[model samples]
Structures are given as C-alpha cells and as structure tokens.
Target: MKYFVTVQATQADYEAMEGTESPGPPRWSREELLAMVNFMGELNNELAASGELLDAQGFTAPAEARFVTASPGTEPVITDRPYAAADVQPAGYWLLECVDLDRVTEIAARITQCPTPPGSPEHPVVIRPIGEAPAP
Candidate 1:
C-alpha cells in the first residue's frame, strides 16, 4: 500500500516561526535548522535508495496560503494565509510505498523525532493509506 505521512504544526508553532515572545526573528538557530535538514535529507536518501520514497516535500509558510471554499451557492470565500485562526496545518509530507500500516506508523514516529524548536514538545505526523486505482 501507499501511504502519505504529513507533518503538522499548530498555529502556535507556526507563529513561533517568526518568534514566540515579543520577537524579531525565527527562534531556531541556523545551525539547528541545518542539522535538522541534513537529517531529513539522509532519511529521504535512504528511502529513495530503497525505492520506497515516492515523493516528499516541505511546504512554504502559510503566509502564502490561499483557501477557497467550493461549497455550492456559498460565494467562494477566499482567504489568504497568515491563517492566524487555523488550529493546525500541514508543514511537510512524504509518500511511501510500504507493506503494512505498522511500518508506516513507525516511520511517522521517527519523523516526529526530527528536532524542532528548543523546548518544543513532540509535534504530530499523520499517516493515511492512499486510495489505489481500480483494476481495469
């Protein structure tokens, strides 16, 4: 089966990207961010070499986000990001082909261990199986 693993951050966490307390810049140090990126790259490389990584990517900040409601008769309400009211949003995702959900969950758990801001608690990684195309 193929699974999508999503990394999520709460609004608070997203806000912290620019600073938590009265701040001027991101809280994470350059070295810290670099290390995390390197670790992630290594993991991705490992998965790719094993041919299990179908796709993976990190998303831009919500500041660039735009939401459109597609409900009928509801004038397409469009909202740009800096979504201060959002409870949670995806930060990154990985598509993996695996034999079982257990393995997928284990991978998600490991990904959650990637270093986050200092003093930050464990964030979340959502995993779900992708729908397969019907056999013709």
Candidate 2:
C-alpha cells in the first residue's frame, strides 16, 4: 500500500518566525543545514534501494499559500496572503509504498532524527495511508 509521511510543525513555531515561509534559514548554520540535507539524502537512498520510495520532496514556503473559501450560495473568497500560522503545516513529505502502517510508523520515527532549530526537539512527522481511487 502507498503511504504519505510528512514532517509536521506546530503553529506556535511558525508564529514565532520572522516570515511565513522557510523561517529565513537564519536559525541554523550553513554546515548544519548541509548536514541535515545530507542526512535526508541518505534516508531517501535507503528507501530507494528498498524500492519503497515512490516520491520524496519538500513543499514551498507557506508564504506562497492561497486560500479559497466559499460559503453556501456565495462566491468563493480568494486570498493570496499566508493563511493562519496557528494551524499545523506540513514541511515536507515522503511517499512510500510500504507493506503496512507499522513500517510507515517506523519510517516516520527515523525521520524524527533529522535536526531542527537548536534547543527545539519537537518536530513531528505524520503518516497517512493513501487509499485507492473509486472505480469508474
């Protein structure tokens, strides 16, 4: 079965940011960021070798977000401004074809080892099963 595993962050952290997007990258050193990137690459390689990795990627900064809200019998309200940072946002995700949820949970746990801002150790990952489409 296919699963979606993504890094999740709290609204509080985003609210504390100087910007809505990527937090400006000023929170970590270049070397530290490079190390995290390398670590992610290693994890992706492992998944690829296992033939479980369907896709893996990070989302663009939240600053580019667009909101479309429509009420009953009303035209949709569209806005390009960043949506509420109080809501949890996905930072990135890995799409994997795993045998079951247990394996997917393991993968998410491993992903927790990825470094975050200094003194902050609460970045979490969420995993959800991608169900099949309805038959025609």
Candidate 3:
C-alpha cells in the first residue's frame, strides 16, 4: 500500500533552521542545520535504495501558500494567506510504498527522531493510506 507521511513545523522552527532570529525558539547554528540536511539526505538515500520512496518534497514557508474558495456562479476567492490560523504546518512529506501499515508507521517513527534543537516540542507526523481508483 502507498502512504503519505507529513512532517509539521512551526514558523519559529523554520526560521530557526534558516538561521533567522525569531521571537521565542532559539535559532539553529550552522552545524545543526547541516546535520539536519545530512540526516534527510541519508534517509532519502536509504529509502530510495530500498525501493520504498515513491516521492518526497519539502515546501517553502507557510506565508507563501495560497488558499482558494468558490461559491456557485461566482469567481473563486483566491488569497495568498492561510485560510485558518495554525501553530504547526506541513513542512515536508514523503510518499512511500510499504508492505503494510506497520511498515509505514515505523517510517514515520523514524522521522519523529530526526535531529532538532534540544527540548524542541515534538510535532505530530500524520500518515494516511492512499486510496486507489477503480479500474477504468
């Protein structure tokens, strides 16, 4: 089965990773950021070698996101802002083909262990199975 796994982070977290000064969370050092990049690279390589990684991508800041809504017989309302306020937003995702839910869950567990600042709050990792369309 194919699964979509999401990793979330707060705006402060993103800023910290970029070596920017934020209000609350401490900023990350150059070495710390490099460590995270290396970890992700290793993980991606491992998954690709195992033939489980279907696709993976990281998104830009939430401020760059756009939301759209429409009503009947009306033009769509498109805005560059988020539709709802959120403390945590999806920072990246991985689409993986796994043997079962257990396998996917294990992968997500590993993601939760990714390197981060000491005492950083743990963000939830969402994993959902992809549904298949009926045969055409």
Candidate 4:
C-alpha cells in the first residue's frame, strides 16, 4: 500500500522556522545531521533492495515557497507566503509505498526523529493510506 506521511505544524511553529535572511539554530549538530541522514539513507536502501520504498526526499523549508488560494467565481489569489488561520501549516511530507500499516507506522516513527526547531514537540508525523483511484 502507498501512504502519505504529512508532517504538520502550528502557526507559531511555522513562524518560528528559519528563513533565508535568518537561518535558525541547528536542530542537530553537523555530525548528528550526517548520522541521521545516513541512517535514513540506509533504511531507504534496504527498502529499495526489498522493493518497498518507491521514493523519498527531505523537503526544503516553506519560506522558499509561494502560496495560492481560490474561491468560487473569483480569480485565484497568489501570495508570497502561506495563509493560515492561526493553526495550520504543512512542515514536510514523505510518500512511502509499503507492504502494510505496521511497516508504514514504523517508517513514520523513524522519519519523525528528523530535527525541528526548539520548544516544538507537538509537530507530529501523520501517516495515512492512499486510496485506489475511482473507476471511470
């Protein structure tokens, strides 16, 4: 089964991220970051060897992004940054094609160990199965 694991963040959490002008503190030491990446790489390699992981990538922060919104009978509004009502933003995500939910949960836990800004513990990695496409 294919699953999408979304890493969610609160508004305050989003605001606290490192921007281009002001890179924040390192969540992990250089060595630690390397180790984490290596670990994840190993996991991915293993999964690929077993023919499980379809694809995976670590995303850049949203500060380097644009936001767009649309409403009925109106032109789409494009903005420089994400617009949220005080409590919602997607921090990152991963797509995993696994054999079962148990495997997906294990992968999600591993991905959650990726670093985050200080003082934010509620940012959780959520995993959900992708449904089959509707018949024509």
Candidate 5:
C-alpha cells in the first residue's frame, strides 16, 4: 500500500519559527535545519534500503484563496479563507510505498521522533494509506 504523510504547524508555532536566529532556538541555524533535512534523508535512505520508499519530497506552502459569495441580484463578496482559524499550516509531505499499514505507521513514528530546527516547531505528521484502484 501507498501512504501520504502530511506535516502541519500551528500559526503560533509558525510565527515562533519565523525569527529564529540560530538552529538551537533564537532562530533555526543552518546546521540545525540541515540536520533535520539530513535526518529526513536518512529516513528515506532507510526506506529505500528496505525497498519501501517510492517517492518523497518537501513541499512549498500552498497558494492563498478567497471564498466569494454572490447574490442573485448583487455582486459577489470576497472573504479570505482560513484553515479552521488554526494557527498551524501544512508545511511539507512525504509519500511512501509500503508492504502494509504497520510499516507506514512505523516510518511515520520514526519521523516524528526526528529533531526539529530551532525556529522550526515540531508538527504532527499524518499518515494515511492510499486507496487501491479497482481493476479496469
């Protein structure tokens, strides 16, 4: 089965990370961020070694959107749409092909334990198995 792991952060957490001056806390130091990246890469390498990694990547933030409403007789109104008014936002994701759900969960757990950069807050990594398609 294939799985997708999504990482999300709260707004406060995101803000706290924004001005980090070093990897430890003041700001995310280059080394700290690199360490995190290295850890992720190591995880990918381990998955590959186990013949489970299919594909993975860190994603850029999504574009902003506005919700608009229009009346039958009036122009539409526009309003910014927030994700549940939560401070957290999705930061990255990973995709993996595993033999079973247990394997996927294990990998996600390992990732959760990896260290985060100073400015970067630890976000929950969501793991969900991908659905299989019906035969054509």
Candidate 6:
C-alpha cells in the first residue's frame, strides 16, 4: 500500500532554520543544519535501496505560501499571506509503498527521529493511506 508521511512545522520553526529572530525556537547553527541535511539524505538512500521510497519533498516557508479559495460560480480569492505561526503547516512529505500499515508506521517512526537543533519542538509526523481513485 501507498502512504504519505508528512512532517509539520510552524512559522517560527522556519525562522529558526533561517537564523532569524522569530517567536519560535532558537536558531539552528550552520553545523546543525548541515547535520539535518545529511541525516535526511542518508535516510532517503536507505529507503530507496529497500524500494520503499516512492518520492519525497520539502516545502518552503509558510510565509512564502499563496492561498486561493473559490466556489464553482465565484471568482477565486487569492492572498500571499499564510495563517498565524501557531498553526502547524506541512513542512515536508514522503510517499512510500510499504508492505502494510505496520511497515509504514515503522517508517514514520524513523521520520520522527530526524535531526533537529537541541530543544526544538518535537514536530508531528502524520501518516495517511492513499485511497484508490475511482475509475473514469
């Protein structure tokens, strides 16, 4: 089965990574950031070798996000601003094809162990099964 494992973060988290002063956690040192990058690369390689990783991607900061809302007959409303920092946003995701829920859950557990600066919040890692599409 296929699953999407998502990692959440707040605006403050993004700011911390950028070495900016936001109401979030303390900034990450350059070495810490490099460690995180390396960690993720290693994890991805391991998953790919096992033929479990289908895809993975990280998102930009929430502040750079664009929002759009519309109804069938109404014009689309658009804005550049994102919700408040307290609201958690999806920071990245991994698409995986695993043997079963247990396997995917194991992968998610590993994802939750990804490196972060000390004292940083333990962000959530959500796993959702992908449903089959209806035949056209």
Which candidate number would show the highest lDDT if scored against the true structure? 6
Best by TM-score: 6
Range of the 10 consecutive residues with the lowest summed lDDT in candidate 3 = 79-88
TM-score of 4: 0.68
TM-score for each model: 0.81, 0.77, 0.91, 0.68, 0.66, 0.94
| Candidate 1 residue lDDT tens string, 60-114 | 7766678888688777889874666345678889999988999888888789778
User: In candidate 4, which residue pairs get closer than 3 Å at backbone N, Cα or C atoms, i.e. clash?
Assistant: none
Alpha carbon lDDT of each predicted model: 0.77, 0.75, 0.85, 0.65, 0.68, 0.89
- Determine which window of 10 residues in candidate 6 has minimal summed lDDT: 17-26
Off by over 4 Å in 5: 10-26, 62-86, 117-121
In what order do the candidates fall by lDDT, top score first? Answer: 6, 3, 1, 2, 5, 4
Local lDDT at 51 for model 5? 81
Error of 1 at 45 (Å): 0.3
- Per-residue lDDT tens digits for candidate 4, residues 1-136, read 8998787754444344423112333233456546656777787788778777777765554555677799998999988785442445566566778889998898778777765445445557788799999999
- Where does candidate 6 clash, by residue pair? none
Cα displacement (angstroms), candidate 6, residue 78, comes to 1.0
Residues 6-88 of candidate 2 have per-residue lDDT tens digits of 98654444433323334432345557667778899999999999999999997665656678999899999999875554456
The CA root-mean-square deviation of candidate 2, after full C-alpha superposition on the true structure, stands at 4.1
Return the clash pairs for model 3, or none: none
Instruction: TM-score winner between 1 and 6, please give it.
Output: 6
Candidate 2 lDDT at 111 equals 90
Candidate 3 global lDDT: 0.85
